[model samples]
Target: MNTIKTIAARAFLISAGAIFYINPAWALLPIQHWTEPSGAQVYLVESPVIPMVDVQIDFDAGSRRDPAGQSGLASAVANMASKGVMAAGGDAALHENALGEAWADLGASFEANADRDALHYTLRSLTDPALLDKAARLAARQIGEPSWPADVWPRDRARWAASLKEADTRPGTVAAHAFAAAVYGSHPYGARTTEETLQRIGVADMQAFHQRHIAACRAKVSIVGAVTRAQAQTLVATLLARLPASADCATPLPPVGEISALTAPAEQDIPFASAQAHVLIGQPGFARRDPDFIALLVGNHILGGGGFVSRLTNEVREKRGLSYSVYSYFAAGLHAGAFTVGLQTRPDQAREAVQVSRDVIARFVAEGPTEAELRAAKDNLIGGFALRIDSNKKLLGNVANIAWNDLPLTYLDDWTKKVEALTVADVRAAMARKLQPGRMVTVVVGGQR
Candidate 1:
């Protein structure tokens, strides 16, 4: 499946809730990190349990780098990558269908996507020497020699525009779009992909974005599988060989500013005909790099992140029956992301539901959680830590996170301890520092009268 349809599906299809704990012997091995000769930062975990390899290469070319008029440029570029690779040396060019068949023949696969903070390309293949070599070379070409077939863009653009129009009809999509716009203001994080924006993007824009933001030096490669340090280095060198060589991290690219903080509370009420009103309440949360990240984690659990056991669920769902489901979470990333509380109830009860959620958040942030609540939060978080890295893909993701955020190499092993070390006072202090109930933005789409 060389097409964007199949590649995008594989990129986003993540499994949830492992039935067994992640094996400490393999998953918990200390990470080995170093800078490669090509200037890409590499993090490796040698787990020989399976004769397979999973590699994720991340670049700082996510949606945040998209041009102003082309909000979906990064995503479009990543999708076009799978269309095929240009020919070079003595080899003939391969079409999308032929390229997909090449990977299938070798029992290997690759996928690419753009998240809020980075563009991710993942390759998976058996550790067999011949197969691995073919997979790596093919992946390198896709990363470096994307053709951006002109014939493909017109058809794909129309498909994308139609898809967005269909998705826009849902209230949930409308609510999320409004909430993001209100919370992120001028930041690129708030940018939305509309039919107009998609129409403005062409194959030329995709090629330009790829050229400007993608380079060998900007790659952060994370590998988890049966590979030694020397082997990994050689593999990385081969993978990035075709890309443009440029200055490393020492030479900064265009700087994306930190998301601006909100000044006063803003509320938007929209009119719609629906049985249930979609509600979103929140403000900018801390960045993943924030020193108080550990404290914020534990506090959010006690506040509303925990499912049935959270304060939001207890007050808004069980206590008042205002909504059947309510949850809160922090989307911390390179910059401060949104800390949102979302729920849906009858259109008439939307106001009460929003008010109840707001009150719960204000009280939790102001007073912090109690001693008992803190213990429970810690217990739940620490108890299920193993489930987070149950598979090779999950382990690769965590390694990638640590690498991208410049987190300590021991971040995974220290996660439970950090959660366990937090005291009630620490949580309270961190919450007080990170959240401002008075300045939050409230967004209700198809809900508020």
Candidate 2:
């Protein structure tokens, strides 16, 4: 059978155009949570509508945890994991080809990736006991026994570095690197992977980094799909069984210090030959843990995040026709991440576009969204809230986010209520507290006077 046929046959045999009705109560579904014996935090949302299950395990070993000068270690470790697994305890090692075939045969998939804030392993498998049991065992082997294949890193590293080299030649890449450096300063978030950094990493380094960080205690596991609390518990145990136990759960990963504030306005006009100028503006914003999250979320939508309807787009893109798109976002994470406003414009109108965008932001921060804007933003956001958790993957992401940020279980259910309750004054107050328009960093690339 082809992949699609096999997946349906294995996971669930239903209609071709199956209408799986997700009960509205599912949005308010209680997130079942518990701590595994290994001290890993577990969050589960039971959706019996389908026979497939989605699982994600997060660890505090993202790029932020990379050692100084080893900028891409976490990513490298994650990528190297699928190359193969080392042999352990009577099961002869499976080569990469064998491993791929095993997963395909079982009609399941596993993936690993490192993001700015964390490393994640996600598995999607049928709830069929036969398929799920084998998938779990195979995933465990990949997670706990990544071979860091000696032959793989050198070839991968060469390709990676060459790609980075090619990317550096692009104007957007140049602008982004500069913007990150300016906003983040000496923080790890500013660190970029370079050919030199890759040279510092090797197979041994990946092995060492994985051993040091991939402990059971640091994992926050999120599950959504067809599984009971008991089954999830067992699954969690089985998946993490081969991982090194946490040495100390109470003592957290040493805090990577927060991004410092911009004390003075810094402006850079990078000369490039590109046709359109890339302009980036703003400074560090709030953290995920900040109580002002809801206010900021709503406020940002009115400011620039809400497309076509935002103040920034209206002011910078609509009226003057300076650029096709203008937007802003808060990269809130474990610490205060960057609040970035960006757009591209004709080289001649770069300065004007930049000024207009900044003016809009300053006004928004000072005066907040107008009552009409607030009403519209709320209506739009609240109306679309259901779509956020409409599917298994989306719900899994919400649960994982809730788990990662240590949010209350009712956070999703209460999301709309909070958004609706927000007043223009509330958005203004939060924006005022978190932003200072004057002290922002302004970057203009490929722009001329």
Candidate 3:
């Protein structure tokens, strides 16, 4: 186990009589990192508090790498990596053991979020040295040597396809699909995996895909647990040793943007389904590297990202009583992704809710946040910054964001100061530059436009 450091917080009262905290100077929770011989980027932070370790490997083999006409190929490759990789024994025993321990697990996931960049594999284990070794080995094997059993692919494909079919009947999912396509027409980020794509994928295809995308250079490794810096390095090296050399096929990701508004209305009538409707509206916003990232984050918090305190929630739900909830957020992915606003309402209230949401967004674009709103947003953001890095998992996530986005090391340290210094002018300027109400792509599900 390694020594863990504590972070202190200092609080003060603002003019509005609200208590807020100034950034505290705490011992650095240093993210010790190095590139493995195989070229995999490795990061580690030790916490002796709990006898557990969480490891994540992010790859460039996201949806962008999918072949044309095979919209969901990238997802299929990511999903299949876990089905008895190179090893003979299946995941059955592993699954049961995970349930028993309630502490260890492994998974392969593809997040095809618009504008975001990578897919990832996550392995978690208890501090027991043996368990940690086994988990890391298994993760490495899954990425490096998936056998893709012929017998298993059929069952997995059938189940996955059926789930996709089921989701197609849901209005919320439909709206999301349409909105993504409208926002990212020709860009790979907009592609949605379908049943046909899944059916066409074979073991060879997955193997080839992994070989090309899951290179050491593309891997972003994150670790947080009861281990020292030395142990962390050994763990990463031992697990990733088997991976093949980096491939020359890796390419820089391209940016996605739209000059005008894109709109598409998709209607689906699920026989005898419930009496509710869902809608989504959005457009490309900012990348993680944007200088105004924090500014927009605070702005979105006041717009629709924050729950009760956001302007969208207040106007759409509290003031007019239109929908249960309405929220907006921007995801800074490998490229700049959409700024999305979404809501759900009773069938009868759908139109009113959509109208109200648009009206509020338009007003926000024009007026930005008031001085009072800016003050509250700053206080809340600065005060809450501590909570964001309170846990190992969260700390690992922060490190991953920093490494993946190529951000400065001073980011986390300077977070509060950045938020605290934001003024009305900053928020208003960010709104004008990023928020695009008229150009937003809107999708209404289970409702007539």
Candidate 4:
């Protein structure tokens, strides 16, 4: 294992009437793991570097699990969860005010977000014993006792619908929605929030979705910073214990259907009034545990993931000056996600930009990265690994991903070794096997339809 050098002397700090030791070398921090009686998996990294603790709790309760025709139910639930809970013993407004006051007194930060495969609630608080206790209890109450208050539903729904309306007017948003619908077809992954779908959602729908999906069995907790093993365990257990102790949360999501091979390249053109045309290209990519994950990750960096040094930038931005920015990425999700290359350029230049990007991708798939490019990618990835987990917040996010995806505990520890072992041939073989340029779907918004 590659170990980061440790500090010869630890520094001491004082905050809020408490003394704490800061570890300068946090790269080697170990993740401690365990399970609660309620079947919630917990991963903790005890770091005393800061007198703060960060907790992230995730459940398999995102939009992918939404009932047919209720596309935004999960997002609605996530948004309302922090607003109020039944444990506060009041109506929606009262409970919301009470929770806000409680969090203010404890000086804690809380956030919730929903994506395709999961819903997450994150909390950050000073690790002073009193503050930590209060924060943890409040977080638990919010998670386990969401009220989904009926009184607030209309207002919240209106706000969400209005936001969607605004987003729909943007060319990039229109293109993205169209691209997803075209790429995934009837798969649940293709579902996007529309005015029609949002109108169909009721508070009862959100409540039912929460009850069926956010159970203890599907929870994953990640805690980091200024806490002991016992404290972390208790924190996670307390938060999740109130959830339904069922064997499973809900029926498993159906597999995303494979993208049909393209007979002719697919394209969608949406006319809009904008200075530049927004373009999106490519197709379904890979899942979290794809065998070619590491290779794809490294290869993507060389191709487009690396900011200014990427081939996409070299071709579209640096050489031809087609756009100010161009990039590509494989969005790995619970199922096969999209591998997309996106850029915005002058209306007249949009088609040429797309062609240039495609040419770059085709050549990359055919020839792969050079020996020097592969070495640079590995060195950059390995050398920068420390920065990725240097902070407690960063480590907590990584741990949450590992837990949610059922990745090996040593995933972080083994990351360097895996990248170091990659060769030009590995990247070539993986890209060749996974990417098919001829079958990619392309979407352009803002140009002539």
Candidate numbers sorted by lDDT from highest down: 2, 1, 4, 3
On lDDT, who's better, 1 or 2? Answer: 2
Q: CA lDDT, every prediction?
A: 0.86, 0.89, 0.69, 0.81
How many residue pairs clash in model 2? 0
Clashing pairs in 1: none
lDDT score, residue 219, model 2?
Answer: 88
Q: Model 3: per-residue lDDT, tens digit, 40-107?
A: 77777766655566677777667777877776666777666655545333543233223323222222
Task: Put down candidate 1 lDDT per residue, 43-78, tens digits, no spaces.
Answer: 999876566689999999999998897899999988
Clashes of each: 0, 0, 2, 0
Which lDDT tens digits does candidate 4 get at residues 1-449?
01101110111124333323345455467778887777678888888757788999898788887888889988988988876788444424337777787676566778888998899989997776656776777777788787777888788888888989999889989999999988788777889887789889888888777787778767788998888998888777767755766645356645545544445579887888999999999888888778799999999999999989999999999999999999999998878888999999999888899899999999999999999999888989988987787677888888888888788888888888999999899999999988999889999998654
Q: How does candidate 2 score on lDDT?
A: 0.89
What TM-score would candidate 4 get against the native? 0.90
Q: Candidate 1 has what TM-score?
A: 0.93
TM-score per prediction, in order, is 0.93, 0.96, 0.82, 0.90
- Candidate 3 off by > 4 Å: 1-27, 87-116, 249-274
- List candidate 4 stretches off by more than 4 Å: 1-25, 87-94, 245-264
Q: How many backbone clashes does candidate 3 have?
A: 2
| Every model: Cα RMSD to truth | 4.6, 2.0, 7.9, 6.0
Cα deviation of 45, candidate 1, in Å: 0.6
The CA lDDT at 200 in model 1 is 92
Model 1 scores worst on lDDT over the 10 consecutive residues at 11-20
TM-score of 3: 0.82
